[model samples]
Target: MKMALSIALLVVMTSSAGAQYLGNYSANPYAPNSTGNAYGAGSPYNPNSVNNPYGRYGSTHSNSSANNPYAMDAPKLYDSQGNYRGRLSSNPYDPDSISNPYGRYGSRFSPDSVNNPFGAGNPYVPDSPTNPYGQGFSIQGADDD
Candidate 1:
Protein backbone atom coordinates (compact mmCIF):
# COMPACT_ATOMS: atom_id res chain seq x y z
CA MET A 1 0.00 0.00 0.00
CA LYS A 2 2.82 2.38 0.88
CA MET A 3 4.56 1.69 -2.40
CA ALA A 4 1.39 2.31 -4.36
CA LEU A 5 0.84 5.62 -2.56
CA SER A 6 4.41 6.73 -3.28
CA ILE A 7 4.01 5.96 -6.97
CA ALA A 8 0.77 7.89 -7.14
CA LEU A 9 2.36 10.87 -5.42
CA LEU A 10 5.27 10.87 -7.81
CA VAL A 11 2.93 10.76 -10.79
CA VAL A 12 0.92 13.66 -9.44
CA MET A 13 4.02 15.74 -8.81
CA THR A 14 5.39 15.10 -12.26
CA SER A 15 2.12 16.00 -13.98
CA SER A 16 1.84 19.18 -11.95
CA ALA A 17 5.31 20.29 -12.96
CA GLY A 18 4.59 19.51 -16.59
CA ALA A 19 1.48 21.66 -16.46
CA GLN A 20 3.59 24.73 -15.75
CA TYR A 21 5.14 24.60 -19.22
CA LEU A 22 3.49 24.52 -22.63
CA GLY A 23 3.94 21.20 -24.38
CA ASN A 24 3.96 20.59 -28.13
CA TYR A 25 0.21 20.26 -27.78
CA SER A 26 -2.27 20.90 -24.97
CA ALA A 27 -5.95 20.39 -24.17
CA ASN A 28 -6.35 23.95 -22.99
CA PRO A 29 -7.15 26.10 -26.01
CA TYR A 30 -5.69 29.14 -24.31
CA ALA A 31 -2.32 27.47 -24.06
CA PRO A 32 0.32 28.36 -26.64
CA ASN A 33 0.98 24.70 -27.24
CA SER A 34 -2.54 24.04 -28.52
CA THR A 35 -3.21 23.32 -32.17
CA GLY A 36 -4.69 26.04 -34.35
CA ASN A 37 -7.84 24.10 -35.13
CA ALA A 38 -11.33 25.48 -34.64
CA TYR A 39 -11.19 24.75 -30.92
CA GLY A 40 -7.47 25.20 -30.57
CA ALA A 41 -5.32 27.95 -29.08
CA GLY A 42 -4.75 30.02 -32.23
CA SER A 43 -8.13 29.25 -33.71
CA PRO A 44 -10.16 32.23 -34.82
CA TYR A 45 -13.32 30.36 -33.80
CA ASN A 46 -12.12 29.52 -30.31
CA PRO A 47 -13.72 32.00 -27.95
CA ASN A 48 -10.71 32.03 -25.68
CA SER A 49 -8.14 31.99 -28.47
CA VAL A 50 -5.89 34.94 -29.03
CA ASN A 51 -6.57 34.68 -32.73
CA ASN A 52 -10.26 35.27 -32.22
CA PRO A 53 -10.91 38.88 -33.04
CA TYR A 54 -14.07 39.03 -30.97
CA GLY A 55 -12.73 37.02 -28.05
CA ARG A 56 -11.84 38.56 -24.74
CA TYR A 57 -8.12 38.07 -25.24
CA GLY A 58 -8.04 39.01 -28.92
CA SER A 59 -10.68 41.70 -29.33
CA THR A 60 -9.24 45.05 -30.28
CA HIS A 61 -11.71 46.66 -27.90
CA SER A 62 -10.94 44.36 -24.98
CA ASN A 63 -8.77 45.66 -22.20
CA SER A 64 -6.84 42.42 -22.01
CA SER A 65 -6.45 41.91 -25.74
CA ALA A 66 -3.00 41.79 -27.32
CA ASN A 67 -4.40 43.89 -30.17
CA ASN A 68 -5.30 46.65 -27.79
CA PRO A 69 -2.54 49.14 -27.39
CA TYR A 70 -3.87 50.33 -24.06
CA ALA A 71 -4.36 46.87 -22.66
CA MET A 72 -3.10 46.69 -19.13
CA ASP A 73 -2.61 42.94 -19.07
CA ALA A 74 -1.20 40.86 -21.89
CA PRO A 75 0.26 37.39 -22.06
CA LYS A 76 3.84 37.31 -20.81
CA LEU A 77 6.97 35.67 -22.17
CA TYR A 78 9.32 33.69 -19.99
CA ASP A 79 12.64 32.00 -20.41
CA SER A 80 12.95 28.24 -20.04
CA GLN A 81 14.26 28.93 -16.54
CA GLY A 82 10.99 30.79 -15.81
CA ASN A 83 12.45 34.26 -15.85
CA TYR A 84 9.97 37.00 -16.77
CA ARG A 85 10.88 38.61 -20.09
CA GLY A 86 8.15 40.91 -21.35
CA ARG A 87 4.63 41.08 -22.74
CA LEU A 88 3.92 38.95 -25.81
CA SER A 89 1.73 41.21 -27.89
CA SER A 90 1.32 41.96 -31.56
CA ASN A 91 0.16 45.53 -31.05
CA PRO A 92 2.82 47.73 -32.56
CA TYR A 93 1.31 50.75 -30.82
CA ASP A 94 1.53 49.16 -27.40
CA PRO A 95 4.48 50.45 -25.47
CA ASP A 96 5.02 47.14 -23.76
CA SER A 97 4.65 45.02 -26.88
CA ILE A 98 7.67 43.44 -28.52
CA SER A 99 6.14 44.41 -31.86
CA ASN A 100 6.60 48.08 -31.08
CA PRO A 101 9.61 49.17 -33.07
CA TYR A 102 10.08 52.39 -31.07
CA GLY A 103 9.47 51.06 -27.57
CA ARG A 104 12.37 50.48 -25.24
CA TYR A 105 11.83 46.73 -25.03
CA GLY A 106 10.68 46.38 -28.62
CA SER A 107 13.23 48.36 -30.55
CA ARG A 108 15.44 46.33 -32.88
CA PHE A 109 18.37 48.30 -31.56
CA SER A 110 17.52 47.45 -27.98
CA PRO A 111 19.32 44.56 -26.34
CA ASP A 112 16.09 43.25 -24.85
CA SER A 113 13.99 43.25 -28.03
CA VAL A 114 13.46 39.99 -29.86
CA ASN A 115 14.00 41.88 -33.12
CA ASN A 116 17.59 42.40 -32.13
CA PRO A 117 19.43 39.66 -33.92
CA PHE A 118 22.48 39.93 -31.69
CA GLY A 119 20.58 40.04 -28.44
CA ALA A 120 17.54 38.29 -26.99
CA GLY A 121 16.27 37.54 -30.51
CA ASN A 122 19.37 35.59 -31.42
CA PRO A 123 18.39 32.26 -32.90
CA TYR A 124 21.24 30.65 -30.96
CA VAL A 125 19.87 31.85 -27.62
CA PRO A 126 18.50 28.82 -25.86
CA ASP A 127 15.82 30.82 -24.08
CA SER A 128 14.60 32.83 -27.05
CA PRO A 129 11.44 31.83 -28.86
CA THR A 130 13.00 33.22 -32.05
CA ASN A 131 15.57 30.49 -31.68
CA PRO A 132 13.79 27.98 -33.84
CA TYR A 133 17.01 26.00 -33.97
CA GLY A 134 17.35 26.01 -30.20
CA GLN A 135 15.35 24.85 -27.19
CA GLY A 136 13.13 27.99 -27.25
CA PHE A 137 11.21 29.60 -24.40
CA SER A 138 7.68 29.70 -22.98
CA ILE A 139 4.68 31.97 -23.41
CA GLN A 140 2.80 32.19 -20.12
CA GLY A 141 -0.62 33.68 -19.48
CA ALA A 142 -1.20 36.87 -17.58
CA ASP A 143 -0.61 36.66 -13.81
CA ASP A 144 -3.56 38.95 -13.05
CA ASP A 145 -5.80 35.94 -13.16
Candidate 2:
Protein backbone atom coordinates (compact mmCIF):
# COMPACT_ATOMS: atom_id res chain seq x y z
CA MET A 1 0.00 0.00 0.00
CA LYS A 2 2.81 2.46 0.82
CA MET A 3 4.68 1.66 -2.42
CA ALA A 4 1.52 2.09 -4.47
CA LEU A 5 0.84 5.52 -2.84
CA SER A 6 4.39 6.77 -3.60
CA ILE A 7 4.18 5.60 -7.21
CA ALA A 8 0.84 7.30 -7.66
CA LEU A 9 2.21 10.62 -6.24
CA LEU A 10 5.26 10.44 -8.54
CA VAL A 11 3.05 9.79 -11.60
CA VAL A 12 0.77 12.71 -10.67
CA MET A 13 3.71 15.13 -10.22
CA THR A 14 5.40 14.02 -13.49
CA SER A 15 2.08 14.38 -15.40
CA SER A 16 1.52 17.88 -13.95
CA ALA A 17 5.03 18.93 -15.06
CA GLY A 18 4.40 17.61 -18.59
CA ALA A 19 1.02 19.37 -18.73
CA GLN A 20 2.67 22.71 -17.75
CA TYR A 21 5.06 22.39 -20.73
CA LEU A 22 2.31 21.21 -23.20
CA GLY A 23 1.87 24.75 -24.60
CA ASN A 24 5.62 25.05 -25.47
CA TYR A 25 6.06 21.43 -26.62
CA SER A 26 5.38 21.86 -30.34
CA ALA A 27 5.51 24.56 -33.06
CA ASN A 28 2.09 25.99 -33.91
CA PRO A 29 0.48 23.63 -36.43
CA TYR A 30 -1.77 26.52 -37.52
CA ALA A 31 1.15 28.87 -38.31
CA PRO A 32 3.63 27.91 -41.03
CA ASN A 33 7.15 27.70 -39.56
CA SER A 34 9.22 28.31 -42.75
CA THR A 35 8.22 29.54 -46.21
CA GLY A 36 10.16 30.24 -49.43
CA ASN A 37 9.99 34.01 -48.80
CA ALA A 38 10.74 34.49 -45.07
CA TYR A 39 10.14 38.22 -44.40
CA GLY A 40 9.99 38.16 -40.59
CA ALA A 41 6.60 38.00 -38.75
CA GLY A 42 3.10 38.96 -40.04
CA SER A 43 4.27 40.01 -43.53
CA PRO A 44 1.58 39.23 -46.14
CA TYR A 45 3.76 40.25 -49.07
CA ASN A 46 7.51 39.84 -49.63
CA PRO A 47 9.22 42.63 -47.71
CA ASN A 48 12.44 42.41 -49.70
CA SER A 49 10.59 42.22 -53.04
CA VAL A 50 10.75 45.37 -55.19
CA ASN A 51 7.23 45.27 -56.71
CA ASN A 52 5.11 45.38 -53.53
CA PRO A 53 2.70 48.14 -54.52
CA TYR A 54 0.06 47.29 -51.89
CA GLY A 55 2.60 46.96 -49.08
CA ARG A 56 3.66 50.63 -49.31
CA TYR A 57 2.34 52.71 -46.40
CA GLY A 58 3.05 56.40 -45.71
CA SER A 59 1.32 59.77 -45.28
CA THR A 60 0.78 61.50 -48.66
CA HIS A 61 -1.15 64.53 -47.35
CA SER A 62 1.93 66.14 -45.73
CA ASN A 63 2.36 69.06 -48.21
CA SER A 64 -1.12 69.34 -49.71
CA SER A 65 -0.76 72.72 -51.43
CA ALA A 66 2.39 71.56 -53.25
CA ASN A 67 1.55 67.90 -53.93
CA ASN A 68 -2.09 68.61 -54.80
CA PRO A 69 -2.64 67.35 -58.33
CA TYR A 70 -6.20 68.61 -58.89
CA ALA A 71 -5.64 72.01 -57.25
CA MET A 72 -7.78 74.49 -59.14
CA ASP A 73 -9.85 77.58 -58.32
CA ALA A 74 -13.34 76.11 -57.84
CA PRO A 75 -16.42 78.30 -58.40
CA LYS A 76 -17.37 77.70 -54.74
CA LEU A 77 -15.98 78.49 -51.30
CA TYR A 78 -12.34 77.88 -50.32
CA ASP A 79 -9.88 78.67 -47.51
CA SER A 80 -6.34 80.09 -47.37
CA GLN A 81 -4.87 76.62 -47.91
CA GLY A 82 -7.36 75.86 -50.74
CA ASN A 83 -9.77 73.63 -48.82
CA TYR A 84 -13.49 73.35 -49.56
CA ARG A 85 -15.83 74.61 -46.81
CA GLY A 86 -19.49 74.85 -47.80
CA ARG A 87 -21.54 75.57 -50.89
CA LEU A 88 -22.68 79.04 -51.94
CA SER A 89 -25.92 78.47 -49.99
CA SER A 90 -24.09 78.20 -46.65
CA ASN A 91 -24.17 81.96 -46.14
CA PRO A 92 -27.56 83.63 -46.66
CA TYR A 93 -27.06 87.27 -45.68
CA ASP A 94 -23.95 88.44 -47.58
CA PRO A 95 -24.19 87.72 -51.27
CA ASP A 96 -21.07 86.39 -52.99
CA SER A 97 -22.27 88.06 -56.17
CA ILE A 98 -19.16 88.13 -58.33
CA SER A 99 -16.83 85.95 -56.26
CA ASN A 100 -17.97 82.73 -54.49
CA PRO A 101 -20.89 83.68 -52.24
CA TYR A 102 -19.85 80.99 -49.74
CA GLY A 103 -16.33 81.08 -48.34
CA ARG A 104 -13.69 78.89 -49.97
CA TYR A 105 -13.79 76.31 -47.16
CA GLY A 106 -17.43 75.45 -47.86
CA SER A 107 -18.69 71.85 -48.27
CA ARG A 108 -21.68 72.42 -50.58
CA PHE A 109 -21.44 73.38 -54.29
CA SER A 110 -24.47 75.37 -55.47
CA PRO A 111 -23.83 77.71 -58.37
CA ASP A 112 -25.31 81.20 -57.94
CA SER A 113 -27.48 80.61 -61.02
CA VAL A 114 -31.29 80.50 -61.42
CA ASN A 115 -31.60 78.14 -58.46
CA ASN A 116 -31.70 80.24 -55.26
CA PRO A 117 -32.46 83.86 -56.05
CA PHE A 118 -33.80 84.73 -52.57
CA GLY A 119 -32.59 81.67 -50.59
CA ALA A 120 -32.20 77.88 -50.80
CA GLY A 121 -35.75 76.67 -50.00
CA ASN A 122 -37.37 79.74 -51.62
CA PRO A 123 -36.78 81.38 -55.04
CA TYR A 124 -38.81 84.45 -56.07
CA VAL A 125 -39.45 83.08 -59.58
CA PRO A 126 -42.87 83.83 -61.01
CA ASP A 127 -45.20 80.86 -60.74
CA SER A 128 -47.17 81.65 -63.92
CA PRO A 129 -45.57 82.19 -67.34
CA THR A 130 -47.30 85.54 -68.10
CA ASN A 131 -46.89 86.64 -64.46
CA PRO A 132 -43.24 87.61 -64.48
CA TYR A 133 -43.63 87.95 -60.66
CA GLY A 134 -44.28 84.98 -58.27
CA GLN A 135 -48.06 85.22 -57.79
CA GLY A 136 -50.79 82.57 -57.45
CA PHE A 137 -53.37 81.71 -60.16
CA SER A 138 -55.89 84.55 -60.89
CA ILE A 139 -58.29 85.82 -63.57
CA GLN A 140 -56.97 87.06 -66.94
CA GLY A 141 -57.22 90.78 -66.07
CA ALA A 142 -58.34 90.80 -62.43
CA ASP A 143 -57.52 93.70 -60.08
CA ASP A 144 -55.27 91.52 -57.84
CA ASP A 145 -53.53 90.20 -60.96
Find the candidate with the highest TM-score and give its number: 1
Best by lDDT: 1
How much does each candidate deviate from the true structure in C-alpha RMSD? 6.7, 32.8
lDDT (CA) for every model shown?
A: 0.62, 0.25
Whole-model alpha-carbon lDDT for candidate 2? 0.25
Per-residue lDDT tens digits of candidate 2, residues 32-108? 21111124211236331111224211012221111122222112322223333232222232243212235222113
Extract clashing residue pairs from model 1: none
Residues 6-96, model 1: lDDT tens digits:
9999998766654222221122334345533344456777665666799776788887666677776666666667665566677777786
